[model samples]
Structures are given as structure tokens and as C-alpha cells.
Target chain A: MQDARIRLFSFVSLSIATFLSVPGAVLSLGWLLLSPGTLRETMKSAAFWVILLFVTIIATATQMSGNDGLSYFIRTGVIILLGFSVYREWHPGEYLDLSVWLFGKKAGFDIGLAVEMSIQGLHEASREFARIRSALSLKGLQPGIRLIPAVGFLMIHTRLMRARDQADLLATRGYRAGGSCCPVFRTSNRDITMGILAILVVFLSFMPVRDIFILQM
Target chain B: MKLSLSAVEWNAGSWKFRADETFTPGVHLVSGRVGSGKTTLALLSARLLQPDAGAVEYEDIRSRTLSFQYPEYHITGSTLHEEAESYGVNPSAACARAGLAGRWDEDPFRLSRGELKLFQLSCLFMRQWDLLILDEPFSALDCRGKLAVCRSIGENRSGIVLVSTHEQHILPKTDYLWEMRTGKLTFRGPLPEAITAWESAPGPVRMLREQGVIPANLTRDDILEAVCRMHE
Candidate 1:
């Protein structure tokens, strides 16, 4: 969705619906597939698969005890896919706009700024990880379990130092709590259509299995 | 020892880089504008990046290391001592050489950007490598640090040292010169002659060249000598 407000709304609504039932997740997945490169990008992310594998392992353990772990896996997977889609469409200030519009200037701006910095930090961490891996290889060291502590330490230390610097920069630039900002949003008809579809998926999830089938028939 | 890039091509989205060159001994200064694929060349030469087309071949060359542009990216150590140790150099000596004496126990991240840069370069320069690709060695370093790095480059008379930077002044006496035009690596040949044809030659060098005086090398002393000769 072009509009941050509508996109966040649909994302939250879809997540709740997907968590409610299997049908909701299936519908949400189908809805997500409509977005251009969501499936391809999500599939390409090693992080996505790693989390999925971890979830799968847990779900398998649950399944061994004769529990309905398959449904849980499906719901979680769909939610992850939805999250990735949201991330793909994210611009720099979208969250700030959404938050400031939702909450008042002071609290919303603080929350939004925190979220923005966190996201920026994540981006930096990924780039730093690549450079660190390169540095390791240059030093004739392979990235293995033994090296995780050193690597993790470097990454965390770097991020913390950067955050400190950023705080200092903000202070030097005369920044204090509750700065003035006017949030603007642009929405397309397609955004509204998809948002409505998200709501419909939620309602569909609430229906009984037989009733859903009957309605479809 | 020789390092060669044979028809090497790397594609990043819409941007493309192609390099076909060979480096053999002495210091080779790679100059280019910002975003001119200098770092990409350094990475490729260091074998950190695999070319899309040809190959980066090394002959009778064993040890190789690439000093990244951002010195902070090289901090694999919590303390200055450990940071130097990570590079297999003596901690105290490296710290002292980088002018961070008695700060061995200090966190590497606590050092200013320039100090960290000088520290990283000092550690890297401590070891002899067959191929040492330094991308922007002078960046973040003050005049003294730059001169120290230039001196280090001057001292390393052996091996293929690819120093890619756009520092306007205070350069080491370079042996060979090369430039990155757009995405293509163009060899400017050996130093003295290369100075005339160097299109992206630094401002001082360009001015001297415009006045019909070509420096013996891209160094402050050489440029001064050339200007004196011009006056004569």
C-alpha cells in the first residue's frame, strides 16, 4: 500500500486474522502474493528461512506430542511473509508518519524516532556483518561457531557506539523531546481495495469450517 | 610476484565494473572520482569479490589483505591491544606506532575515527603482504597521519601495493599510476610520464601540468621541485 496508515492498518488486521485460523493465513498469503515481488524476495532472504527452520523444529517437537503444530507453522509462516512484504514496501519515514498521525506529537514522535533508529541500526548491522565476514576471511579465519562471540561482540559494540554518537549529534543539533512535524499520507484506490480485502479475510477466519464451506458452495 | 585482473567484470544492479590490468611490485596509486569503483577493484583484487566474467589471478603471491575504507569495519577487537593482536602484531608496539601509546586497554571503538584509522593502518602495515590493497588509506587521517601512511608506503618498496585514494595532496612517491574512468580501469602507466596523461590528476598536479611542468612523481616534494625548475 502506498499509504503508510492503510498499510500498517492492513498489516495489523491481517496478522490478527492469520493468527485466528488456518483459513485466515491461507487468505492472507494469497493476498500477499498479489504484491509484485514479495514471494521472491521473502524466499531469497536467508534470515527468513533460518527463522522458518527454527520454527519448524519447534513445530515438529509439538507434532511429536500429537498436537496441531501444522496449523501453528502455517500461521507463523504467513505472518512472516506478511511482515516481509511490509518491510519491502517500507520507506524511511513511513513509521514516523503513521505514529505521529495515530498518537499525539510528543509520545508518537518519540516512539516513531526510536523505531526509525532501530530499523536504521538493523540495516547498518547487516552491512557490518558482511564487512566483518570479509575481514575474518582476510585474516585466514573461517566463520564458525567458535567465532560467533567475537563477531557478535564487534557488531553489538559498533551499534552501541553508533547510537551514542547519534544521540550526541541530535543534542548538538538542538534536538529535544517533542519536535514539530506534520505527517502527510498519500493513498491509492488499490491500497483501499487491498485493505478491505484484509478485513474480509478476518471475517472469513471467524466463520465455522462447515459454514465457510457452505458459503463457498 | 604478480597480481592480474583478466577481463574481470562485476555487475551490481545497473552499475557495471570492468578491469583488466596487472600489478607487479612497488606501489601502484589508483586514483578516481568518488563512486568510481576503486573499492570494488580493491575487493576484487583481494579475492573478496568474484568477478562476473574473467578472473583475478595471482602468481607467486601468497599473503594478501585489504584495508577497508571505514576503519571501524576492521574492529574485531574490544581493546586496542586485542585489535593489534588480531592482526598478529605486537599490541603495545602497534599502539605506540599509531600514536595511541598507553591506550592498549582502551576500547578500539572509543578512539576517534582518525585514530582508529591510523591504528588499523598501522597494524596492517606491520605485516608484509604480497598484495596489500588499501582503499582510501588517507581518509579520516590528519596531515600527520597521512604523512605517516605515505612514509609507510614509501618504506614498503616491495610487493604490489594498490593504494586507491583521492587525497588532493601529501601522497607517497608512487611507482605506477592507474585511474578508474566510469567503471573501466585504465592504466596510466609509470609515474613520471603518467603524470601528464593523468586526467584526474589532483588539483596541484593539474595546475603544474597546465603550466607545462610535469612532476617527477605525485608527491609534495616532487611538485615543488617541478615548480622550481619551471621558475628557472
Candidate 2:
């Protein structure tokens, strides 16, 4: 959805549904799959399969042989798919705009700025990890348990240095505790339809659908 | 021994880099503007990054090291002493050589960026490598620190050292020069020839050429001597 508010609302409503009811969770996944190209992109990630396998293993070990195990696996899959869908559509700028629109300019701006910085820090950390890994490889050292401390220290050190520089820049720019930003949003008919569907899914989760919804194990 | 790229093509995000050049056993200075793929070429030469289409061949190379643009990325030590020791070099000696004699016991993360670079350089210099790639090594250093690094580079005769930088004025005495323009290796030749032939030579070189004085060498000292003689 182009509208940040609608997207956030839909994500939150779907998250609640996934946690509450199996049918609701399945509906949430279906809604997530409504976005074109999401399913293909999600399936392409090896991480998604790994996580699914891990959850399946846990379910098999704990429940052994029963409908409960199968249900657990299905629920876990639904949750994972919901998360993947949310991440695929995540936009830092939209989050910032939504935050600023919801909260007053000052407090909302601070929160939004923090979110933006966190996203940027994630990118930097990934790049830094690659560089550090390459450096260690060049030194004839394999990345094992021992390298964790060094990598962690370097990442923390870099973040601290960046924070210091950012502080200096903020000071130089005469930044106050609360800054203001103009919040703008554009909503479409599709966004409104998705938002209503998300609300309906959350509402459906509260209804007792044990008689109607059944999964053969 | 030589480190050469053969029609190597690499991509960084949306930008594409192509390099086809050979670096001999000498101080080779790779100069280019920002985002001109100098670092990408340096990484490829160091074998840290593989090319998408071609090969980076190392002729009879036993060991190699790549010092990244940010020195902190190369640091894996907790303390200054341990940082040097991690490279299998004497901590005290490396610290002293890096002009960080009294800071051995301190956390390396506490030191300034330039000091960290000096410390890393000292450790790298202590070991023998067939290929040394320094990417923007002159950055975040004082004049004396820069001079110290230049002296180290000038004194070394062990292996092929590739210095990738955009700093034109404070460059070391390089034997050969390579210029990257818009992701293409545009020039590769002797230093003197590069200074005279390169259309986008540094300000000092262009100024000297404009004044009808071309130095016999491309080092700062040689240029200064030539300019002094011109005045005399």
C-alpha cells in the first residue's frame, strides 16, 4: 500500500490475527500473498526454508505423531510467511512518515529519525561484516567461534565512532531535542480495500470457527 | 612477480567496473576520482573480491594482504598489544615503529583513526607479503604520519604494493601509475610518463607542465627540485 498508515495498520492487524487463530493466520498469509511477487521472492530465500525446517524439527520432536504437530507446523509456517511479507514491503521512509503523522512533529520526528538510523546502521553492519570476514580470511584465519569477539568489538567500535560523529554533526546543525518534519501521505482505493480486509481478518480471529475450519493431518 | 587483472569486470550496486592491467613489483599508485572503482580494483588485486567475468592472476605470489580504506575494519585485536601480537609481530617494537610506543596496553578501539591505521600498517610491514594492497592508506593521517607511511612504502622492496588513493598532492614515490576514469583503466605506464601524458594529472604536475618544467621523476622531492632549478 502507498499509504504508510494503511500499511502499518494492516501489518499490525494481520500480526494479531496470526497469533490468535489458525484460520486467521492462514487468511493473513493469503492476504500477504495478494501482493504481486511476494511469494516468489519469499520462496527464493534459503533462510525461509531453513527457518521452516528448524520449526518443523522442533514440532516433530515435541509433539511426535499427532494432529497437534501438523497444526503446529502449519501455524509456524503461516507466521513465517506473514513476517516475510511484512519485511518485503518494509520501507523506512514510509515508517518515518507514518510516525510523524501519528505523533506530533517533535516526538514523532525523533522516533522516526531513530528508526531511519537503525535501518542505516543495519546496512553498515552488513557491509562491515563482509569486510571483516574478508580481512580475517586474508590473514589465514577461518571464521569460527574465536572470531566472534573480534567482530563484535569492531562492529561496536564502528557504531560508537559513527554515533560520536553524528552527535557532532547534530550539534553543529543546532539540532534540538524535538525536531519537526512535514508529514505527507497518499492513500489509494486498493490500500483502503486491503485495510478493510485486514480489519475483517482480525475480527474473524475472534470468532469461534472450530466447527467450520478443519485441516486433515 | 606480478599481480594482473585480465579483462576483469565487477559490479558494485549499479556501477560496473572493468580492469585490464598488470602491476609489477614496485610501488604502483592507482589514482582516480571518487567512485571510479579504484577500491574495487584494489580488492580484486588483493583477491578479497572476485571478478564477475574474468580472472585476477597472481604470478608466483606466496602471501598477500589488503589494508582496507577504513583501518578499523582491519583491526581484530582487543588491546594495542594484542593487535600487533595477532599479526605475529612483537607488540612493543610494532607500537614504537607506529609512533604509538606508550599505548600498548590500552584498547585499540580507544585510539584515533589515524593511530589505528598506523598501528595496522606497522603490523603489516613487520610481516613479509608478496602482494600488499593499501586502499586510501593516506587518509586520516597527519603530515608526519603520512610521511612515515610514504617512507615505509619507499623503503620496501619485497613485493608488489598497490596504493589506491585519490590524494594527488601527498603521494609517495611511485614507480608506476594507473588511472581509473569512470570504471575504466585508462592509463597504465611509468610514473614519469603518466605525469606527462595523463590529461587529468594532479594540480602540481599540471602546474609544472604549464610552467615548461617537467621533472625527471614524479616524487614530491623530484618535482620540488625541478621547480627550484627552474627558478634558479
Q: Of the candidates shown, which would achieve the greatest TM-score relative to the real structure?
A: 1
All candidates: TM-score:
0.86, 0.82
Candidate 1 to truth, TM: 0.86
Superposed Cα deviation of residue A194, candidate 2 (Å):
8.8
Q: What is the C-alpha local distance difference test score of candidate 2? A: 0.82
Deviating ranges (above 4 Å) for candidate 1:
A104-107, A180-197, A209-217, B1-24, B51-55, B77-81, B91-96, B100-111, B181-184, B197-199
Query: Model 2, stretches more than 4 Å misplaced?
Result: A1-57, A65-94, A183-217, B197-200, B229-232
lDDT string, candidate 1, B155-231, tens digits: 87698899999899889999999999888999999979999889898998988888899888877789899989888
Report the CA-based lDDT of candidate 1 relative to the real structure. 0.89
Best by DockQ: 2
Estimate the Cα RMSD of every predicted model relative to the unseen true structure. 3.3, 4.2
**Model 2, position A51: C-alpha lDDT score:** 96
